[model samples]
Target: MIESTAPLLSVRDLTVAFDTQNGTRQVLHGISFDVMAGETVAIVGESGSGKSTAATSIIKLLAGTGRITGGSITLDGEELTHLSEREMERVRGRAIGYVPQDPMSNLNPVWSIGFQVEEAVRANGLAQGRAAVRARAIEVLQQAGLADAAKRLRQFPHQFSGGMRQRALIGIGLAADPRLLIADEPTSALDVTVQRVILDHMASLTRDRGTSMLLITHDLGLAAERAERLIVMQNGSIVESGPSKEILQNPQHPYTKRLVAAAPSVASQRIQAVVEDRGVETLEDLAAIPPTVRVAGLTKDYRIRQGGFRSEMFRAVDDVSFEIPRGKTLALVGESGSGKSTVAKMVLKLEDPTSGTIEIDGMDVSGFSRAQSFGLRRRMQPVFQDPYGSLDPLRNLENTIAEPLEIHGVGDRASRRERVRELLDQVSLPQDLATRYPSELSGGQRQRVAIARALALKPDIVVLDEAVSALDVLVQAQILKLLADLQTELGLTYLFITHDLAVVRVSSDLVCVMERGRIVEQGTVDETFANPKQEYTSRLLEAIPGASIPLGGL
Candidate 1:
């Protein structure tokens, strides 16, 4: 359905700037690109690289003092740069659709899902009556991969899971059947399997409707696999632009090379680079090490209240057992709602297992008294997924890290202050950042602070629950390298829980694949990835966004 001759969308010499307290500051400079009818284009870069700024500029949705300083934006040869607010409103949903990055922030919590989609349909004049709008809403939701859309139309955003909410947003974006769809990091936070379903649905729907797509993301693997042409952006400039395969195989820019090397999906093939960089022992050499934490017959269940006086027992974790060898890593891999986090909570003693035995260095913790539990806390700690949520916004970096040591009564105020600086150094954070609050730091820096806080007590066992899942590829690589180096230097153990299989390959010695409430497969990382025994495990590997595309291959 694509027309190879003419461009559906075109932008030339686009320059954007913002009026800051320090005066005018330009963010994007001389950016130009074209998207042919039904073709997909992707803009890739790290945070603050002006990728999202460009996308937002196309829709004239920039916040605050942002304005287009210079450039021309045209759609179907219609100039849009100088359009009035009122005129742009008519062109928004009717000619161009936008799927924002975060569904929780974009979707209204007070409204039902059906109302939102219906509103878009009515606003674009795609449907005449309320009944027609409702019918169209259901159709779009179903096309977006939400099963039983009609039955769940009345549900609020909070009632749906993260994946379901994302699908709902996609449904609303496509409700008007716009000519162009701009998806901004649509699958960044989703599990690989859920991401695959959403992406596949978008591909089929867009192709069927002849909708040209412009994807904005930091993930090079995803962009390489999905986009027909790739635009590599750095410091608000286009360093490289070419066919995705050609750019991957022969990157002309230094930034592009760094991006490819840092990406986890492709880096799995060059994992030895990580080991060499950290000088850590291979998994085979670490096999004889005794486990720092051991679990046997772990099970967790919850009672869900049904109708009056009735409840149903739900098994959140069923007979889940794994071991983290001293100075080694054990990764739990699964999709969302697969009991990986439940198992982590049980191990960290944050949740009580219905029936199981947890032994930390041969000390049974199932029957620990209050005093004994407090003692256990000093030896094991947790680093959660959302650093923003985990860190205390009111507390500065020093106090956040020092709080743990103070809780355990480890040292005096003076000694604790020195320890905070040392912990910052250990996590590769600048010492000057100790006085900055969480809000002042970037996402990667906040996560480093969280890691420093977890290590304040010198815990032998650290449980990282999706710790690197939210990070950019380069930041994730740095964090993983730091973890590996710390493991080698301090001999610490890690219980790594994540839905990202690409990460498990390079960072973990052992892999456990969980599904429903049980582990469907467990083995060494090499064995499991090389020959997955379970169908679910194989499916998960296949679901990785760019799994089929070889690194640096045409």
Candidate 2:
């Protein structure tokens, strides 16, 4: 793992600027860094910290009037700042491979996985004929840790799972035998276990190929674990830079310290503690007091066709049971395709359970009529993971939040609009945002807007499915705090679904660990996290980025 003395990629006094409607705003303020031959370097910080801006500027791919206003970028002793569009294209794939953050956005949905890889291979002149290019595509996918590469050659991006799509993207990036690879938050959207697997495979692949990597991410802990060297950025400048272990052990900068502390690893104890006189006193008292939401023996099966009319039954959720007391939070945790989301869907009425009984405030929903189902929906609401996607793009914030009230015939236009204002205030969003659209707001702002919309109906139970997983540490912290505050103020029950164990430890009262299609473990978050009975649960905790780093000082 020792890198040579000579630097493979050297960036000096680099500055980046974007032209907004107001004026040109400079983002990266004369930053400098280097990547040694066969070395992995990570630039870590929160969103808008210039990690991605700097990475994009290197290849002259800055979006919407953004440009490298100052400094030099030299790769393999070649000055890249002066390269033309055509020349840069030649360097992009063959010399410098790039794996972007979102695989769905990066990969074309219309094309098969193999077609994209073959295109990259053929474009680089790696192979002449289509047959040869296809063989190279399979080999590239195998290198990216995708099993059954040949059989999945015809699969579209939508047909593949999240991990599979990421592997396909990696395959396309590394197809041309590039000397350097730049992965920008490549596995940020994946679950912790899947993230670990992808990163391990990527590390092994790069090491074996002797390809240097410039990893861009918002996760300081993940950067510390994945990279040999770390460069911390804040407000468009490098606050600290050094060996990963050294900086991780003792973060010197205030922002870096904030990141370390805000990381779910060293976070708050619990979202909201139960009072001695109120809420469930103990687990045994659960039967004495009626739970707000109860799910029992939930099972869901989907029939999937295997080429011909031959279809097989696939059980998504199987015999899972849990309960959330009034105003308490229960976290559903598992890897991808682990039935956590399916369970959430069943509770939310998005999916029908093959066999189960779901009770809301002691009212069983199995035989509910149309009017009862409508009433049930009004009592329950969901805050989805993708805030922007969940909200209507065409509607303004006020309309979006008021839509639920309108559909349920809650109030008049004036009252609904006033309620919208109140909900926004409750979520800490400004009133002026009512007129704005989803595209105009930041990720955090959109999430707040989503929360405001979810609370419009004044539902008793809220289903948060991977709510804060996509946000940065700071924004995520703010969202978690907001949820906690809302829960206390509104007496709302939550069925939180996520893959982040650290967040589960702090945000929920109870934790239910699912694997494949079954609930493997369920208990109090503190007890379960402190002493995980299942090895799968233990492995998940260990898979957390930089879990080995001691955070006692932080």
Candidate 3:
């Protein structure tokens, strides 16, 4: 189905470098590829492997120290590499569209979705009249698989869910109908179901529109399914490229082979082993303690606005009930829109439930006073998804981690510093890193800092919302091990909200499967994973991508 005439985008002997004090460090070394019209070409590589650098270089968005030192880039026979800033700006949105990696960071939080999309449309000279622009925005939002697009456009970024934000970003990308679309990890932040839906929408849209696509992702399976050609990059070099199926099945390069093998599927890795080491506390340990937190008949309903003041009550968490014991982990697993995070937010008192009895340590926390809530907060801490975003960008590591101690008046200056140091050691961060800001640290290091910050208060329970999902496999394993070690040392409890079943199997004593605001299944990790009773649970288990491959091979 690929149209292989004159290429839509072409790059020859591309080279990019960053000027560090040590010298010019080559990031992308002599890479060349052609993307034809209506064809999808995927670029796959590990983190820091120059995959994103390549994309950024193409758009001339590379950092101050980085530049494309050599190579020619052409789109529709017009050279793009040597364009002026103003000229490039004119060509960017009109000739080449872009969907960034994280929609949340890319979008304006204060603006309504409509204004953002409309601005994109106006910038590209797509529509003249305001009404026409709004109409086009709604149409594009619907094309991106968002329901009630016109009504949803009025909602702010925070009001919309993470997946919805991704859809909004995609809608903005398609507003101008650019000749080529450059999507950089568009679905990485989304849950599996939402990811599938978005990918299907993108594939369908580009095919129908005859728009060429350049997909940059770490997910090989996604590339295999969507792209016509595959270009593998590693250590700032192009290692291989050819037909997608051929490369996937018979990769010539070791890196490509590893990438292909890492594609997780249902038949790949079996859910057999415990996440924790043997001789650790099991289900019996949970049975020993009375419930630490209990929710019975939990429900939340939002008044959704339709047309001209018309409203309808939408239930997000519908009669969900569960219990968590002290010194154990209770994992809530589901794809996006499955209401797992809604339950966590309610538990954290970020959102008030419409109806439910939520008891913490045999007492109801649903209606706690300010003082009582402060006490509850001291008992329940949170570790969010993005460590870099959560931590203070302006504050140094010591202040950021020790701020909790200062807030609660736990210890004086000397004692707090000592505690901060101890916590840093506990999380395996170097002592020297205490002076650095969050921006200076790598993704994994930032996450470690977040973990240290979460543990600073010595909270009895920690709500980890997709805490380790963003990390690489090796770093993820380290963090998982650290969590287990912490549980043993501190006897801490965790409310782990994640879509990763592997994390559930390894870290949780109990697993709760959520679907559309309801608890579809709940049991011991072994029982539920090994013998999932409900069809939804079975499907979740089945949806564990590339599970059949051996970990060593991957």
Give each model a TM-score.
0.96, 0.95, 0.81
Poorest stretch of ten by lDDT in candidate 1: 266-275
lDDT of each: 0.88, 0.88, 0.83
In TM-score terms, which candidate is top?
1
Could you tell me how far off, in angstroms, the CA of residue 138 lies in candidate 3 after the best superposition? 5.1
Task: Residues 1-554, candidate 2: write the lDDT tens digits.
Answer: 96458789999999988888999899999999999888999998888888998888888888889988899999999999999999999999899999999999989999988888888898888898878888988898998888999988898999999988998888888888789999999999998988999999889889988999999998877988889999999889999999988887888888888887777772347755344445434566544556899899999999999977799999999999988888788999999999999999889887878999999878889667778888888889999999878989999999999999999999899999999999989999889989999999989999999888889999989999999999999889899989988998898889999999888877888889999999999987777877889999999999998877765227
- Candidate 2 at 401: error in angstroms? 1.4
lDDT score for candidate 1 against the true structure: 0.88
lDDT of 3 by residue, 1-554 (tens): 96458999999999999999999888888999999988899998877888888888878889689999999999999999989999998888788888999887899988999899988888888888989988878887998889999899898999888888988888888767788999999987776666767887888888888899999987766677778898998999999999877787788888776765544443333222235445434567667788888889999999999889899999999999988998778999998778889999999988999999899889998888888888788888999998967998999999999998888889899999999999999998989999999989988889889889889999888999999878754456577778888887888888999987756777788999999989999988877877899998887765553333233334
Using lDDT as the measure, name the better of candidate 1 and candidate 3: 1
Give a tens-digit lDDT track for model 1, residues 160-203. Answer: 98899999988888877889999999999999889988888888
Using TM-score as the measure, name the better of candidate 1 and candidate 2.
1
